[model samples]
Target: MATDSEKLGIKIERNPPESKLTQFGVRKWPNRWGCPPSKFPWTYDTKEICYLLEGKVKVTPDGSSESVEIGAGDLVEFPKGMSCTWDVSVGVDKHYNMG
Candidate 1:
């Protein structure tokens, strides 16, 4: 987990056991999102939790040169008000929920 005064809040559990995260149930986050290799900007209006099922991505927060790499089997959390650019290197597939 990491946080910054002017940037986003992110909590990542790398390679967590599938059982631990899956217990939350897919029904809770029935929507799935996928993107081909590309870069795009996004803003989180609400806190979000996502489970990556495939592919890889590098997320760079707005105005910062720093970034985080995420891939399959990763559990990621993004706090509300965080704005960032997602640079998908190998495309992406994930299940997500907002609250």
Candidate 2:
């Protein structure tokens, strides 16, 4: 069965290989850090690919009841123009690129 993330058009790969990270040059991407117990709305102006180094979060797309859970060791992609609310339960540290 398709996961909630798939249904929401949010892609997530858990604990991907190092080669894949290297292929995407994930280490070179700019980093983003967020503290826990916060909620904020965000809209993606461009597609974003990120690799989470630490922390956990739940992102609920606008107009949806479900939230997609993401955490450390995950590689995730958020589509361009997607509007969502980020609920950060744990502090986050990640590398991200937008295009």
Candidate 3:
């Protein structure tokens, strides 16, 4: 089963089957992002869902020490207004779009 956790408005769903995600229209996201290992900061103005196709990342929300690790086959949601830093430890490729 997929596991989901929410804190400070971010949500992560681990290891969700691709079929189930497709059924929910996950593939409809218009953008595909690919990045080499790096660290960057971001802020979301609208909710965003990311479906990882490869590699991994750790997202640390601004002002919080806690972080969420995401990788291939994972589904992650960043809520509106959240500020965070992404540490792409293994680089990554994913489909993402605003919700």
Candidate 4:
């Protein structure tokens, strides 16, 4: 596999038979699998727009213990300085934007 830094800005499409792809701090996708993965809190230095293309995730904020499950076609936004832990369950395919 080639590094994204070594390639042009491209989009990875998740279609039938092919699933699960991650692009650095750009985007990730998991198809049909249960319980995607647990990840570290993201306190983005840049604004992040997360749109749930499928499945559910438990998003727990830092400093505060509040969490929520956002699923299919849902939208979530986090500005700079916001930190949170992401517990993705029942798989997920989402588009991400960070710069």
Screening candidate 1 with a backbone cut-off below 3 angstroms (N, C-alpha, C), the clashing residue pairs are none
Task: Give the TM-score comparing model 4 with the true structure, all chains together.
Answer: 0.56
lDDT of 3 at 5: 81
Which segments of candidate 3 are over 4 A away from where they belong?
A: none
Candidate 4, 1-99: lDDT as tens digits: 221111011122223121232323224522223346666566678766555568777777676556765666544556666677878766777666554
lDDT of 3 by residue, 1-99 (tens): 888887667777888877878876878878999999999999998889888999888888999988878889888888899999999989799988886
- Report the CA-based lDDT of candidate 2 relative to the real structure: 0.86
Residue 61 displacement (Å), model 3: 0.6
Best by TM-score: 2
| Local accuracy by lDDT, each model | 0.81, 0.86, 0.86, 0.52
Q: How many steric clashes between backbone atoms does each model show?
A: 0, 0, 0, 1
**Rank order by TM-score, top first?**
2, 3, 1, 4
The TM-score of candidate 2 is 0.89
TM-score each candidate: 0.85, 0.89, 0.89, 0.56
All models, RMSD in angstroms: 4.2, 3.0, 1.5, 11.4
Q: 21-88, model 1: which lDDT tens digit per residue?
A: 66867436888999999999999999888888898998998888898888887788898998999999
In model 1, what lDDT does residue 13 have? 77
